[model samples]
Each structure stands twice: as structure tokens, then as C-alpha cells.
Target: MAFEPRQTSVGGNIRQAGERLFAIVEGALEEEREQLALWVPVAMGMGIVAWFLLPNRLEWLGFCCFSLAMAAGGMLLPAGGRVRQAIVLGGILACVGCVLVWGKAMAWGTPPLPRAAFMEVTGEVRSVSAIPAQQMSRMLVRPIDAPALPRQIRVNIAQKDVPEGLGEGAIVRFRARLMPPAPPSLPGGYDFARRAYFQGIGATGRALKPVKVLRPSTSAPPLRARLFAHITGRVEGPGAGIAAALATGDQGAIAEEDAEAMRRSGLAHLLSISGLHVTALIGAVIFLLMRVMALSRRAALDWPLMLIAAAGGALAGIGYTLLTGAEVPTVRSCVAALLVLGGLALGRDAITLRLVAAGAVVVLIFWPEALVGPSFQMSFAAVIALVALSEHPRFRAFAAARDEHWLRRVGRSLGAMLLTGFAVELVLAPIALLHFHKAGMLGAFANLLAIPLTTFVVMPLEAMALLLDIGGLGAPFWWLTARSLDLLLVIAHGVSASPWAVMMTPTLPTGVFAAAILGGLWCLLWRSWWRWAGLIPIAAGVAVMSMASPPDILVTSDGRHVAVRASTGGMALLRAGAGDYVRDMMAESAGFDGEMSALADLPEARCSDDLCAVRLDVNGRAWRLLLTRSDMLIDKAALQDDCASADIVVSDRRLPPWCRPRWLKADRRLLWRTGGLAIDLNQGRISGTKIASDAHPWIVPAVRNRKARSGNQL
Candidate 1:
């Protein structure tokens, strides 16, 4: 009874504190409920990103059951229980996102391909694009009789492999070896198979016989495809391919060296029809329409001038999206543009963070799988940073310096451009490093020289050329467009040659990368001073990334290539295959930024026609690794030598157990099942991640034994 007074004092103190906190929050939100509602969609997007990162896809029945339960619970809640109601509403929205993703996955399911010696593929050509870099043409075909396959199959036909008169809607038949989409080149890497599943491509193959056209349809090809064909045909210069890429979002024809140069120089984003391009196009439309409206002020006065501009801008964005086949990035940008334009029409805040969040919500609701793409991540990161910077007092002051002297206006404009570039880099660099292990070091300067040219010159000229082509006066405009592209290419090449053009770093841990993203969002979206707290997580991410280490060894998914860290600091390859795709992936995965051929020769390696033996010294201790073909493993003398000397034996076949007790054998069986291996010599461990851990229904199980793979198409 004596302690009752203390308990009463504690309860009274807690009650008073809670009341004060509630009053403060209520005051803050009194007039901002509508603005705060914008975050609901952003939260929904967060849930979608989380859903895609799940190890296994959600089952439809389970999702539906849970969603129904959540909805019923929310509906049953009393009106006075605001906190409980908010919790239930958030749960329902998250569950809705998960269910929508599951539905999309179900819609993408297709019948499996038959395992036969020769697949007689007969299909109508849906589209054809050339990869001049690889001397190959990709044909998307709609199979007629291949019931065991998806509706479409992508066939890679080399110049020497097939006859050349392929066009859209032309029926063609060829003999080919159909194989499943290539799996991720490394464990825990991007799943090309999962992407293919969403793209409705069940199989890929190389044409073995000449493509024989059975019939040609009367319908015209897609506008984007026709535009690509026209650009490739009419323009005959180094810049022609880039013009097509810029106009139609098709970069397959660009030279490999040029593409690499653009990537290194940070100009690659311009090559794609991304957000900047869309914004420029919309701005151009608005400016042109406003000029025309100025000539007729009476009509402009009758209608809201800004509404007309917004409507025209929205139309331009939509047209551009359709012209680019509504690619993921374009779709995302278009949604954002439409949202802001719609807000303008409704007389709302069109440039707020809420508008951005609203756009993200729309895109995720329609195409949630895009949450896993690097483009989506980078695009949103840049947008969030730019928007946040624009809201700062200094930036607003700088932007408001338009009434000053002409030279001052020009200086302010230049400063704004510089600040925009720097802010975008600050936000996007971490994402690029986390995914690609490299940041565009010369990106700011490159954008300064490149963006104005592309926006004011190249894109405008391309649009004019399109308009002129309809009037039979396109040749000069096309030439002007090509010249502008050539100048941009010159800038890209020159900047790429700089010593500090690319900053290569090791990969960040997944947790740290996610934390950085959340921190950026929190800083941008929060309205109070507490937003400054986000800086802690951002700093932590930087510290962790600085300390991260690259993998010491990388193995190809097929066991055909293996790279080990050499004493000279570059990766030494076991073999160089006909195609460098897998080898490049391995090099990038291990954070080897130099040319692949720069790998130092192994002086400690002994080589024969069938096998090579090398000594691996990690730290001060030496270990032996043997690389051998399946046939060579049958030789008893060489096998005994390998078993006696090697700490680890690597082969494409299972060998007899004649090794020392300490020796570790990496045989074909393990590699086949796991896809690849990344070893950490410093930690004396290997990453245990397996391909199956992130497997989807589209990925068929890997054959476990030699007998199962005897006649299988891998």
C-alpha cells in the first residue's frame, strides 16, 4: 500500500508525456494530411521491393487467403481506433503489392521446352535487331507449332548462320538447338532466367539451318522497329547506330568499344531514352505549344494556359513512351511525368516529393518487377536527390536570381547545372558501386558538356527529322542529327580517355546498400528536423563500402572458365573461350577493372596438352590447384601426381579418390549444381550461396548426375 503513491506518480508522468507528444504530432499534421498521404504509395513501393527480394516466390493461394483476412480485419476495426486502423491499412496495401506480383508471375508462366535432339522451330518473326558488336542478329519469333515452348523464342543468327531477309510478321522455319535462358553467370548474381520468364522467352538458340520464309504478313511492323530499320538504312556513318539508339531505345547496333567508352565516361544514360530525355521532350512540346498559343491570346485566355501546356506535355511523354516500346525506364518516367502534369492541371503542388512518391506508387502497382532493376534504382536515386536539393534554401535563392544582370543569370544557370550534376552523382554513385562495382568519376564534367548538346541539339534534331520525314524533307535534318551525335560521341571518347574516368571499387554488402537507399529516402521525404538523423546511416554505408573486399576467385557457371587472384593483383584465367561474355562477368564479379588479358602468366604453373598445374599462395602458405579436362582425368600417372601435390583439384569430371586426406576436390558435380563459386582467401572460406536459393518456377532444376546430362541441352 505504501508503494501505490510511486506507481501513481509514474503513471501520471507517462500519461502527461504521451499527451504532449500527441499534441505536437497533431499540430504538425494539422494542415498537411493531404501531403502526407503521398507517402502511402511510397510505402507500397517499399513493400514491392521487399517482395521481389524474397528467396522464394509467394504462392497465390496463400497470398489471397492472407489478403482476405487482412481486409476483413481492417473492415471490422472501430472508427475511433486510428492507430489500429492505420496498421491494418498498411498491412492491406503491402499484401496487395505481394498479390499483384504473384499475379504477374502467374501470367508469365509458359509450357516447358521439349528435350529433343533437334528442335524444328517454325515461327512468325515478331522483330529483328542486329548486334553489330557481335556480328549477330536477334530475331524474336512467335512459334507456330512449338507448343512446349513460350509464345516467343529469341534466336541468335550469325551472319554466316542464316539467310538474311528477315522482317516482322514473316513466317520462317529453321532447325536449331533450343536451350533454356542462360542462368546467372555467378551465384547470387542477376538472374537472366528470371528476367526471361517475365519477358515470355522460354528458350534461346542459334539457327543451324538457313531461315526459310514461309509467308509474309500484310500488317506493318511496330513503329519503333520500323523507325530502327529506317535509321539503320538511311544513315551511313559511325553515328547512325547511336542515333537509332537515342531515338528508339535500341542499342544493339552500337559498336562495343563505343558503348564501353560511353559507360566509362558516364554518358551511357543518354544513349537510352531515359527520364532526362522524356523531360526534355515534354519541355520542348510545352514551349512550342506556348509559343503558338501566344499568337492567339484570346483562345489562350478562354482556356487555362498552364493546363494546355500540361496536357500537351503529357501527350508528348506518352508518345515518346510508345515510340520506345514502353521500356521499363520509359514507363517509369512517363508515369512520373503524367503525375506531375496531372497535378498541374488540378492546381496542386506539381514538384513536391509527394508527386515523386505518387509516381513511384503507380509504376510499382503496374510493373513491380522493375524494383529489382539497376535502372529503376539509379533513376529514382537521382530524382530524389535532385528534388531534395531543390527544396533547400540556398538552391531556391540561387534559382530566384533571374531578375539580376544577364551575366549574373548566366552564372547562376551554370552553377545550378553544376550543383544538379554533383547532387545526382552523390546519390547514384553508391548504387552504381553496389551493383557494377564502378562509378563514373568524370560524370559531372561529362554531363556538363554532353547534356546541353543532347537536349538542345541532338534530341531536338531527331524529333525534327521525324517530323520532316513525314513531309519528305528529312535528309538534311537526319544529317544534322547525325552530326550532333558524332560531336557527342567525340566528347564521350575524349572524356573516357581521362585517367580518372572511372572509379572502381569492391561490392557493398546487401544490408549496407539497402540502408543507404532507406537513408536517402528518409532524408528526402521527412518534413521535420529529424530528417538529419538519416546522415548516420549514409555515413555508415560509406564506411562499410570502404572496408569491403573483392572476391579472390571466380568460377563461371558452366565450369568452362575459372579465374584466381594472382600475386600481381589481376585475375589469371584458366582458359579463354570463344566468347568473352562469361569471362567478362567473372572479371567484373571479382572487381578486376583492368583488361582481361592483363592477367599475369603463372611462372609456377606446369602445363601439358590436357592439364595445367599451378601453385596458389594465399598469405604465406602455398596451395596447389590442378585444372584438367574430363578425358585427361583418366590418366593414372597424371592423376596420381595431381592427387599427391595439389591442395585442391578442379576438373570437369568426377575422378577416383586417390588424393591426400587434406586435398579438396572441386568436381563437375558440385559446380553443375551450384552454378559457380566465389572464394575468399583472406577468410579461408567460400560463399555458400547457391543458385537454387533464389530459384523461380521458370528455372528448371539442374540435372544432378552425369547420366542425366548425357544427351541434354544444357
Candidate 2:
């Protein structure tokens, strides 16, 4: 009898604990019921990412079919509990997203130029972008008779070579040297070829001679062009480019030095047409419209002035978006603004994660490729973090509190701005590191002054100047706008000059990036105490990234340039005369901002006419690298002996089968297969921008030229 009573007591205690755990989970689910829809876009974005990561279009097609089947099956599932329903819905949305991006890639992907060529090009100009800093202009052209070329090609023409009145819709003929869109200079670097493919740009080239205009444009110039010209003409000096970039989305005119300063100081977002500019414009319009409409007492008393003002703001936002070429960031902002306006008209609060999610879905539906871009990731991340911060109970209570003194209110406003900036920076740091390998350390402080100045003084003055220019009364506003821009540039340069301005990092692994992003989203998306648990993954990602090491050797796709890590923890270039573009790319990839030394000057390197031999200490072992310096034939015996002894070999010429390196043979043949390479001796790994086996529309597989057998036989 005693043993039976003890067993019953233990069973009763276990049953009570299980019931409590179930109740807790059920409560959490109920609390999050209304927020379930917010994850739909996130699931879709995951699918889009998967599509991009897949190796080939055939696999993408197969995945699309699989996704569709899953979605269909999800629809047929029985009415389960909320957890099952949520899982099924998320799976369905993810499938839809995968299918959507696959379809877009099929419809929009363009074939890249197979090889470089010099040809007489006759085409109609579809669009033109000026690069006054370089004294050049680029045009998007549709070929007249070249059936072998892509539908559109971007050609750069010198200022002196550009024909007169060669605007959009003009027929022109010119002799040009064209080349395939360049691939990433280093592994994990920017993929210019992929970007160009999606943009319908197959080739890029520079004109050899002056362009001749066969026919002039019949229609008037685009409004965006007109506005750009007007702003550049009105404002003198570097400020003109800044003003133009702010008004329109064309950033080509900005001086390179000035743009770099802006980027380093974290003020570059001001140059882009994004949420800040759109919100300022819409808010100003609504404020002015309400004031004007409410001035009529009868209208204010009886009319829906708020609704009318909201409509006016929406129209202004839409017009601004179109005027700025409807770039992705501008379009995203416009969509979000329109949603907010709709909420205002309906008397509901709408500046929430749900609103952001809706805007993301709309953009993804049309431009799924944007999911991979830095702009979309950073913009959405900042917004999500800010919204989540604002929704916090403590933040809401503080914001809603009434201040007794005007100074206290001002302090409160500033505090709020500071908090919001910190949150944005926190969330966007990983993304910036992933894309650019650097994040602005002082961006929060810089934005405190830059955001207000651009929002209140520069943009408003520019808008007024453009508006008043219709009556020839814009001189004063134009001057004020220019002065404001000058101040903004000053701030940018001053902040960027600080030694602690930026935090540079080595290329982040994709898994680390994913962990950070997921953790941030978890922290931002959830409304319960468990959301704080996301910090564990975020911390873990940071820890891993801090311990990660950069590659020891970097090689270009063509094997023309090589950068090796020196004992001083800096990069040394095989060719000292390599252009700034190549040097900077190598430096960035190596996460070394200091000056690069010449390999010949290093004590561990010896250079001859045809080859440069280097010795690097990696993982406590001396690694020998034989890099070709010239195309001249090397002594066969000496080359084979060197290759046999070397750990890695790089050359533009194909090596013989007997001349094999123990670790890697990154010669012409291998480089042709794996675009650009990063070799990590510490990890015994090699990463390429384009994998040897990767098959994609934008990637042209390399094939050996049967006739080119002169060098290999030696």
C-alpha cells in the first residue's frame, strides 16, 4: 500500500509539469497569432536565396516543380492546429517564392559576351549616364544588326568622342573595343557579371573613335535627365553632383573622392533615393496640404482634410519615385509610404512590421533578384530594427510620455533618434561586413547630424529650388541648397578622416552571415522575452568571425595579377605596376588597408625575367609559390624543377602535365575554370568566385582552344 501511494504521487507531479509546459507554449502561440503573416515574406526570401545558391538552371527548374507540388499538397492538408497550419503556410509561401525567382531568372537572365572583340558598332541609344568626374559618358545601346550580341550593351565614350545631341533614342555609330562583363576580381567580391546579366547588359566597352550621330532623338529628353542637367547647371562645384544624386538616382556624376568619403563616413545613404528622402518629401507634402486645406474654416470643419492630405502625399511620393527612375530602394520606400497613407486614410496605425513585410512581398514579386543585393538587405534590416525598437514597451512608454519642459522634449527627441540609429547600425553591421568587408564604426554619430541636415536643409531647399525654377525665382534656394551640401560633404570628410571611423573585416563565410541575420530577425520579430535568446547566435557568429583568418594567396581570374601575404601581415603584389582597381580589390579581399609592397622587394622572394618565386610562412610551415612574371618561355628543366618543389604555382601559360604543384596548380587552364581564387593555407582550402562545375546563364564555361598548343608542349 505504501509503494503504490509513492508511485501515484510521482505520476501526479510529472503530469502537472507536462500540463504547465503545454500551457506556456499555447500561450506563446496565441500571443503571436496576429504576427504569423509577417513571416510569409521571410520564408519567400529564403526560397529566393536557395534559388540563387543552386548550381544550374536545370536544378532551379526541378526545384520549381518540387515547390509547386509541395504548395499544392500544403493546400490539401487537413485543418490542423495553429502550429501545423503556420508550418504548412510558411512552406507554401517558400515554394511560391522559389518558383517566382526561377521564373524571373528564366525570363530576365541574359547571355554574357563570350569573348573580347573590336568591332564597328551601330546602335540606338536607350539611355545615357554621365561620368563628369572621369570626363566620360556611358550609354545603354540596342544594336542595329548584331544578332550575336545581347539586346543591350553598355558603352563608355570619352567626353570628346561623344557626338553632339546624342541623348536617348538617338542612332549612333562608332568603332569600339568591347569585352565581356568582368567577373568578381576576388572570391567573395562583387559579382559585376551577374548584376549585368540581370540588367540585360552582356558586354561593356570603350569607344575607340568619336561617335557619329546618324539620327537625333525625336522625343524630349526624360524628366530625370532634365532634372539632372538643371541641378548640375544651377549648383557649381562638387556640390552639384551631390544635389543631382539627391534629386535623381544618378550617382555617376559624384566625384570619386567625395563618394568615398561619404561611404566611409556612413553618409552614402543620403546620396541614394531611399526611405529618408521619400519620407521627408511625403511628410512635407502632407503637412503643407493639411495646413492649406485647413485654412478654410468650413472645409476643416466638414471635410475629410486628413484623407485628402494623405492622398496628396501618396501622389507626391509616387511622382518622386518615378522621377528618380524608380530604383529599387525608391520603389520600396514608395510602396511603404503608400501603405502608410492608406492606413492614415482608414484611421489605423500602420507603421509596423506587417507594413514592412507587405512592401517586401510586393518588391519580391516583381524583382526577386533584389533579394541578393546589399541595398535591399540593408534597407529592410534597418527598417525592421527601427520598427521593432519602436514597438518595445519601454521605448513606447518613453516616446509617449509628455514632457513638462521644452528642453526636456528636445532632449527626448534627440535620445529617440540616437536609439534608432544605434539599433539600425547594430542590425546592418553583419550585412555591411558581408558585402563590403567594412562597416562604419562612427556611423551612428555621423548620422545624427547628417540625417537632420539632409532632411531639413538640403533636400527641402533643393525641392524648393526646383519648384521655384519654373518662375525664375530659384537662385536663393539653389544657393542655400549648395551651401548645405557643402556642409554635408565637410562633415563626411571630417568624420571619415578619423582613424576609428571604420571597422574592416575579412570576408565573412555565408553561414556566419546567415546566423547573424536569423538571430537579428528573431530578436526583432518576436514580442516575448524569448526573443532575447537570439543574442546567443548573434554572439556565436561574432565570435566565429573574429577568429576567422583571411586567405594567404589571391589570384585574378586571368592569372595576370597575384597578391601574396607577406611576413609583415600585409599583401605584396607580383606586379608593382598593377592598376589601382586591382590593388584596391586585393587589399580589400585580404582585409589589409595599408600600402602593398612589391614581391620583388620582399626578402623571401626572388624574381627573374620570366618567373618570381616566393616563400610564405603559413600555419608554421614554409610554403613555396612559383608565379609567372612574363610570357617569355621559361627553361623547361628549371620550370619543371621549380614546379616539383613548389607548394603552389600560378601562371598565365598552361603548364605541362609533369609540372604539377603539390597543393594547387592555378595556371591558365585552371584559372579559366575557376574564375578568381583565394587560397587559405591555414585551412587547406581554395574558394573561387565561380566554381569550376558551376553552370549558370551568366557563367560561360571555359573550353580549351585546340589550335593553341604551342606553349603547353614546351
* lDDT of each candidate versus the true structure: 0.74, 0.86
lDDT (tens digit, per residue) of candidate 2 on 188-249: 79988888988999999998776888998777888888888888999977899999999897
TM-score of each: 0.89, 0.93
Clashing pairs in 2: none
Residue lDDT tens for model 1, 591-680: 677766422257767766677777778778887777774364356875787677777766766657674414456666556556667777
Candidate 2, lDDT over the whole model: 0.86
Give candidate 2 misplaced runs (Cα > 4 Å): 1-27, 61-78, 701-714
